[model samples]
Target: MTRDHPADFEEIARRFSHLWQALNEGSPGTRKILVDRVRDALDRGEARLRDADCDIVANSFVLEALINDGAATRVYRARHRDLGTFHAIKMPRPDHADDPVLRKLMLREAEIGMGLRHSHIAATQTVLRLSDGRPALVTEWIGSRLAELLQQRPLSLGEITSVMTSVLSGLEAIHAAGFVHCDLSPLNLLADGDLSRLKIADFGIALKRGSRHSQFDLAFAGQPDFASPEQLAGEPLDERSDLYAAGLLLSLLLSRCHEESDGTKTLKALTNHLSQQDVQDRPENARAALHLLGGSPKRPVDA
Candidate 1:
């Protein structure tokens, strides 16, 4: 169907099911025809649901574009039909959509995010259920990921300071809310152009303070380089665990800046203190780490 004359839900589903069956059991000629039909449906921007229940989320949001196709989830830049506001809708990959373990993880991330409200924390607006009974998280739209920005250009000392301060501030709030942001890598941080607006995103593996890690947590362990020593050991974690990751995140920023001034040296020292192998060796918390950077917890670094 053409974009102006799109296929209805029923027709789309029928084509999708036939394609699935063809791939598995149909003759070669039939499989080729089914493939072409499905491709045409997608090219026309027609909605295709793997299961009947998938329509709830598909119909609610007008997916503007695919933002990121990650290993487990696909994030879309979507506009909510009723609200008329843009958001990042995170849905599990089709293969993972029906997995109970992934559903629980997404639910847990939404639960942790809903309680957090900070300028440096990306808000989780709400969770929508897919037609197949899986959960999708609706989050504030952030156009840039820190990882992408780092690849584009080197940041100035002021930019690094600003970004690190924002991250620590976010961690402070997360810890105060009784949770540790188990994931704090560059990929999980969001920022706008010029490093002016930065926020922490992705709490898929965040754990409550003093709470034991679940089996699902193991599968989603954050980036290896950013994971704390205690986290790698599967030991009990507290705010300090997140502090370690924050320190590494700062180091990642500093590595790209290529400056060796006194200010840079100071930040490097702070990074060392934050990433100490022993939890006690690091700053007591994010607040203390901020102080070591010669700044107040409430005031961000001058950008």
Candidate 2:
């Protein structure tokens, strides 16, 4: 009789047989040693699997460098093989690739993003499924994260207004589309050099307007610092919830700037209004917030 064996078949069989024998008739010390050996072998196998999964690549794009190593996903700067254009490719971390909740979040982000077309919103190009069944999101490449930029220097009044104007405009579009950007923080905003362009990115935890908290868990939703009072309480969310986050974002930007100016005082008051503990105390929606910011309502631009 002939038999086929895998590369590690002999090693695996030896370990298993030794464990079985120890369990049945070996001394206590022998059993303990065999059990430890089995555990070590299992750990090695899992390590190999994790290493293989970490080397993910797509057929259409070449990953140039890792851009962001986030809690749930890893973003890479990649170039499309045929188009030769750069794009931001986001994929779930190796540990999260097979998690159903994370996969659902990625799909939800794609769906919400595909419908939103605006200059101030990072556009989702497409979702690519890897051979290993992991979904990767392709989005427009922006220069830098707002968090990174803020770390370098404080913005001038003009720069602050420009960034806030762009962000509120983007929020208006997102709210109009009937979705709340549940997660809005400095890390989620992308900006270009010269402050000419800023776009909202990452809709991974966006909630539909008026959606009940029961639909999704808020514990893992928005950032605690930027989250509205109602969001932390697990209450239903609306456009006001997003406005609250926008208010918090404005406050953060203001903190980075020089203080005690007349314009800074005015913005501080607005921030207080937007981030009021009571949901009803905040602006009704993004449009209303923009009105408070002394900006005209601009029509949404196509991506």
Name the candidate that leads on TM-score.
1
lDDT of 1 by residue, 243-281 (tens): 898888888888898767878888888889898988889
lDDT of 2: 0.81
The C-alpha RMSD of each candidate to the native structure, in angstroms, is 11.5, 14.2
Q: On residues 1-303, what C-alpha lDDT tens digit does candidate 2 reach at each position?
A: 225557477777997786697787988888777766765566556557774543324545777889989888999998875578989989988778788878987898899999899999999999999867889999999869889988998777667777888888999999999998888898899987745478999888888998755575435577899988888888888999888888888889888887456677777777898888888888888888877777422223222
Quickly count the clashes in candidate 2.
0
lDDT of 2 at 243: 84
TM-score of each: 0.77, 0.77
Alpha carbon lDDT at 261, candidate 2: 67
